[model samples]
Target: MFPFINRSGTITPRLALIRRMAEFTGLYSWHWTPAEAEAFTSHLRSGPKPIMVSTTRGYEIPIQMFCAYISDSRYGWLEEREQRFGTVPQQVFHEWNTVLHVAEYEGDPRSRPLHYDEVQRLFDAADGRAEQIRARRMKGSVSAIRGAALVKTLYAYAYGLRRQESRGLDLVDLRRTPTNRSWN
Candidate 1:
């Protein structure tokens, strides 16, 4: 009735953590609680060679996905778990326990787009800033104008630029593309 998420990139390491967690906690991973998962991560961090943030996040995702898979209502895993065992599975690996200080911005739901009035207000504010700078006889009128144009362009066309993308912009990026129409 469903397809598996084929999102394994580069490599998908075995869930060797399950064996480790079982050995560490003296319980199977299915029996381990959120606290145990947290402890496991903490243990990794406190080890002689600590893991990186990205690697830690990578570790958490598989465990989290496993819990999610078992607990999903449609899959009948929960029903089977409840019927056979007196317990139901829950998602133990969460934002609080896992690596949140990601070097790259990612994996957030699109929350609340700007309303029509809000969008207009933002563009107006950018334009107004440039006008204000010019009216005050500011030395950086050209910079302010460019800034206003940049803000408008970002909102209107080049939306969803990440921090690194914004920082990586150059004068060449601002150059107009060549039109196919013959200029001769």
Candidate 2:
């Protein structure tokens, strides 16, 4: 019954495993550099739930830690950080896992609107070559900025949805809210 509810056609057990894996490994993945992770976590603390909790009606279980948004701190793969430091910081990993669990259990707010500075930091933190290419593509136009903005927003929203669904939120609505509304 729950299987049919999956918009992505994934099985419930598989979804459960994915959510669990993200929960267990998110702290260790270095998916974002440590600095970025710290910043992202800080942003959450400064803003909304820090953890978004969502549930399916009639279900006895609830999912947790839906998303792990990284800030612009140490921006690189986990391995790089590990290789450089010989180990990942436990405190960082702990906080990351905690926030991720919250994002997973709670429905992530669709758009975490970023200010210009944050966007710039994200650009710097992302792959250097990719950022360069993206910047070049922008060629300094309002359209370029708009395009980048759309991509970032979409990426964040998709990540949140995936994390939520993995945790059993099983979100079905991908519909965009009115543009006039703020996503913060």
**Cα lDDT, all candidates:** 0.71, 0.44
TM-scores, each model vs. reference: 0.47, 0.18
Per-residue C-alpha lDDT of model 1 across residues 96-169, encoded as one tens digit per residue: 67778743444332544566698889888888888998999988889988887777666654664566776787
User: Best candidate, TM-score-wise?
Assistant: 1
lDDT string for model 2 (67-114, tens) is: 222222355544555688565432233433433343433444566555
What's the TM for model 2?
A: 0.18
Clashes of each: 0, 21
Give every collision pair in model 1: none
